[model samples]
Target: MAAGQVDELRKRVNDDWERIVELLKQKIALGSVSSKGIAADHMKRSAQFVADELIKVGVDAKVVQSTNPDGSAGAWEVIGSKIVNEQAPTVLLYAHHDVQPVPDASQWDTDPFVGTEIDGRLYGRGSADDGGGIAIHSGALQALGDDLPVNIKVFIEGEEEMGSPSFIPFIESHREEFDSDVIIVADSGNWSADIPSLTTSLRGNTTLDVTVSVLGHPVHSGQFGGPILDANTLAAMLISSLYDEHGDVIVPGVASQEVVGGLQRDLDEASVRADAAVEPTYTMAGTGSLAERLWTKPSITVIGMDVHPVEGSFNVIANQTRIRLSMRTAPGQKPQEAQQALAKYLVENAPFGAKVEVTPLDNGMGWAMDPDAEATQDALQAMKEAFGVDPVNKGEGGSIPFIPELQRIFPQAQVLVTGPEDPKANAHSPNESISLSGLRNNVIAEALLLSKLGGE
Candidate 1:
C-alpha cells in the first residue's frame, strides 16, 4: 500500500462524510437502549440495519441471537465479513449498537433520539460513544470498496451499555466466528479534540444493588422524626462510609496498581471542570496525579437511587431505600474482588441497626496492553498519517469489560482500542456528541490501519 494510495482512500472517506453522518443519524433514531428490555425489538432492528449497511458495502453480514444472563432473550449481534485476501491476517472491528437510556430527556439541547448538528458536532445519544464508531467501520469499508487489503470481520455488539452480560457466553458459543489476528475496539475516547489517543488500558468494573430497611411500613414523620431511622438516612450514611474526607475510595482490599510510563497524558483539570460543568468554587478530590486517580485508582459512584421525589412531599419515614452502586476497579484488579469488598463494606456499615442487603449485578476484569507491541506501533503510525499529527497514548478510567474478554479469548491477537470520542463528547451523559471532523479522521485512520495490517 503506497502513501499516495492511502491518501486517496482518505480523500474518499472525507468525500462520503455526509453519507456517513446520515447513516449514523438513522442508527441514533432507533433508540436501542439495551438495559431496557422494551427496547429489544429496536435493538434487533438496529442490528439488522447494521447488517444491511454492511451488505450494501459488499460485506457478507448476518444477525446472530444472544442469550442474556437471566435466560431471557438478548439483542442481536451483527456479524459481517469481507475476505479480500485470504492469506492476510484478519482484523476484527468492534462497536456497539445499543446505547444508554436517556434518563432525563429534558436535559438534552435537542431530542435525545434525533441527531442534530450544532457547531460542527453531532448531538444525540450514542452519537460519539458508539454510533460514530459504527459509521467509522462502514465508511472505511466503503472507501476501500473491493480493493480492501485485509480480511475484515465486523462485530457490532448488541448490549454493551448493559455491561455486556451476554458477551462472554456469546463469544464462547461461537468462537470461530470471532477468530481474528487483531481486534480494534472502537469504544474509547481521545485525550482531546486536537490530540488523537490510543487507549492502552481500561479499568475493571462491578455493580451491585443495595437496599436498607429500617421499618416495615411508612410512618408519619411528625410523630417519628426525632427517634426513627429512615431508610434514606441509613442508605446515605452507608454510602458515605465508602468515601474518605478527601473523596478517595476507602473500600478495603480493592487493588490500586501504579501505572508506570504507559501513557503520560494527564487530563487538564480546567478542561475537565468545564466539560463537567463544575462550579468555579468546587475543589478537586483525591490524592495523586489526575491520570493516576482516574486511570489507576479505585473509584465508587452511586449511579441511581430508588427514593421518593422531594416534589411529592410525603413527609413520612420511608420503609426501604434502594441504590445502585457502580465500582470501577483499577487495572490489574479483579472485579469480583472489588464486588465482594463493596458488598462487605455495605453490610458491615449498616447504620442505626438497619438491615442491609446487597446483590451483585455484574462484574468484569480490567485489562492493560503492551504499548510496544508491533500492531500498536503500526496503529500509531496509521493514526499519525491520517490525522497529520502525533497521536497521544492514554488509559481510560471507564471499563469496556469485553476488551479483557476478547484478550482472554484471543491471547495471541493484538487489541487496538481507539475511537472518535473526546473529553467534550460527553459520552453516557446529557448532550452527548461527536465532532464531525474527528469522526472523519477516525475513519481514515481505521482504513489505513486495516490496509497496513493486511500488508503485514
Candidate 2:
C-alpha cells in the first residue's frame, strides 16, 4: 500500500463519521448485559443484530453457535466474514456485545440506556467502553468496499464485562475458525484526551471472600459483654492487616515491576484530603514510579464489608460476618496464585479465637503486549496520519484476560490495543460517553491501519 492510498482511506473515514455514530447509538440502546444465568437470549439477539449489519455491507455473515448449550440458555457466536486473501495474513477484529448493567435513571441527566448527545459526546451505558468500538471497526470494513485484501474476522463476546468465563472454552472449541495473524482489541482508552495510546500491558485480577464466625449465635451484648466474641470486629481486623500503615500491600509472593515516568498521579494536599475522605492520602511509603505501583504491584481492596447494623438499635453480638476482597496482580504473577496468597494471609493473620474462612470466587491472568510488534507500529502510523500526533505507549490497570489467551494460542500474532476513547470517556461509569472527534479520528486510523496491513 502506498502513502497516497492510506491517505485516501483516511479521508473516506472522515466523510462517514455521522453514519458511524448513528450505528453505535442504535446498538447501545439494545442494553445487552450477560450474566451466568441470563446470557443466552441477549447474546443471540445481539449476534443477530451484528449479522444483519454485516449482511447489509455485502459480507457473508453468520452466527457460529457454541457446541455446548443447555436447552436455550442463549447460544453465543460471531457475525463475521472471511475475506479470503492468500496474499495477506489473516487478522481478527474483536469487541464485546454485552455491557455493564445501567445505574438508576435518576442519577443521569437523561436515560442511561438512551444514547444522549451532550458537549460533543454520546452518553450511554456501553457507548464508549465497547459499543462505540464495535461500530468503528464495522464501519471501517464497510468503507473498504467489502473487497478486503486480507482474511478478516470480527469476534465479539457477550461475557466480557462478566469476566469472560465462557470465552476460553468457546475459543478452544472453535479454534480453527477464529485463527488470525493479528488480534486487534479496541475496548480500551487512550492515556488522556487528544492523545492516542497503545495499551502495552494490562494487570490481571482475582476475587476472594472471607468470612469470620464466632460463638455460632448472636449473644446479648449487656449480658455477655465480658467474654462475648464479635465476628464483625475480627473481620475488620483481618481486612485492615491487608495493607500496612503506608497503604502498601503487605502480602508476600506477588510480583512488582518498575514504573514508567509521567504516569504517576500527583495529588496536591487538598486533592488528597478530598479523595481519601480524611486528612491525608496515605502514601505507599516506598519510592517507585506510579505505574509500577498501579500496573505491576499487588493491590488489595475491600469491596464489601458485611456487618450487623443498627436499624432498631440492636444490642446483640453478631455471630457471623464476611467481606469481599478484590486483589489485582501484576502481569507475570498468576491470578490463582495471588488469590491463594491472599487467602493464606487472611487465614494465618486473623485475630485469636476467630475462625476465618477464605474462599476464592473468581480469577484471570494478566496480559502484556509487545510494544514493537507489526500491529503496534502500523497502528501508531495510522493514528499519526489520522490525528496528526504520535501515539503514546501506555499500560492499563484493568485486565482483558483474553489477550493472554490469544497470545498463548497464536504466538506469532501481533496484538494492538489502541482505541477511540480517552481518560474522560467515562467507561463503566454513570453516563458513559465517547467523544465525536475521537470516534471520527479513530475510524480514520483503523481504516488506514487495515489498508496498510491488508495490502497486496
Name the runs in model 2 displaced over 4 angstroms. 1-3, 29-45, 67-72, 111-116, 213-229, 259-287, 312-320, 352-354, 454-456
Which residue pairs in candidate 1 have backbone atoms (N, alpha carbon, C) closer than 3 angstroms, thus clashing? Answer: none
lDDT of 1 by residue, 1-456 (tens): 567887798889978888899999998898888877723677788899989988988889999888877888766899878888778899899998889999999998899999999999999999997998999899988998877888888889998887777888888887787899999999887777767788878889899999999999999999989788789888999988888999888888877877633545677898778867999999988877888888889988899999998896788999999999998898888899889988997898889779999999988789887777878888888888888889888887888778888999989899999998987898889999999888888899888888788763
After superposition, the stretches of candidate 1 with alpha carbons farther than 4 Å from their true spots are 35-41, 103-106, 207-252, 279-282, 302-326, 339-361
Worst 10 residues of 2 by lDDT: 259-268
Cα distance off (Å), candidate 2, residue 270: 9.0
Query: RMSD in angstroms, all models?
Result: 4.4, 3.8
Top candidate on lDDT is: 1
In order of listing, the candidates' clash counts read: 0, 1
TM-score of 2: 0.84
